[model samples]
Target: MEGGLRRMSHHPRKRVEKAVGALNLAHLQGAFYLLFLGCGMAFILMVWESFMDVF
Candidate 1:
């Protein structure tokens, strides 16, 4: 029984580590996507503003 518990404990620790790694990767991907979206929107806005000024 003790040996079984010890082995099970190792599995949970490994699972937790994997979950944390996945969460970090998700956060990084989301941040990069948001940054790209923001940059694109800003560029569009700048172009629109310049067009308005020209008119």
Candidate 2:
């Protein structure tokens, strides 16, 4: 009975680790996406400003 309890505990610990790893990956991906979006918007604004200056 004691050995069975130990085996059951190990499975849940592994599942927790897997869940934490997946969450970390999702956070990193979201951060990178925001960074790229900000950079693209800045580039577009610069182009627009330069065109306006010429006119």
Candidate 3:
């Protein structure tokens, strides 16, 4: 009975730990995507500025 109770308590902690790890991974991926998007926008603006200068 005592072992069963202990296992039950530990299970939730393990689940919470897994959830935290997944969240961190998702945060990292989001940051990576934002960085790429910002860089792409900067490149497009630079191109447009140069094209405008030609006219």
Pairs that clash in candidate 3: none
Candidate 1 structure, TM-score to reference? 0.74
Candidate 3 global CA lDDT score: 0.99
Report lDDT (Cα) of residue 36, candidate 1. 100
**Of models 1 and 3, which has the larger TM-score?**
3
Report the alpha-carbon TM-score of model 2 versus the true structure: 0.83
lDDT string for model 3 (1-55, tens) is 9999999999999999999999999999999999999999999999999999999
| Residue 30 lDDT, candidate 3, scale 0-100 | 100
For residues 1-55, could you state the per-residue lDDT of candidate 1 as single tens digits?
A: 9999999989989999999999999999999999999999999999999999999
- CA lDDT of each candidate? 0.99, 0.99, 0.99
Q: On residues 1-55, what C-alpha lDDT tens digit does candidate 2 reach at each position?
A: 9999999999999999999999999999999999999999999999999999999
TM-score of each: 0.74, 0.83, 0.78
Clashing pairs in 2: none
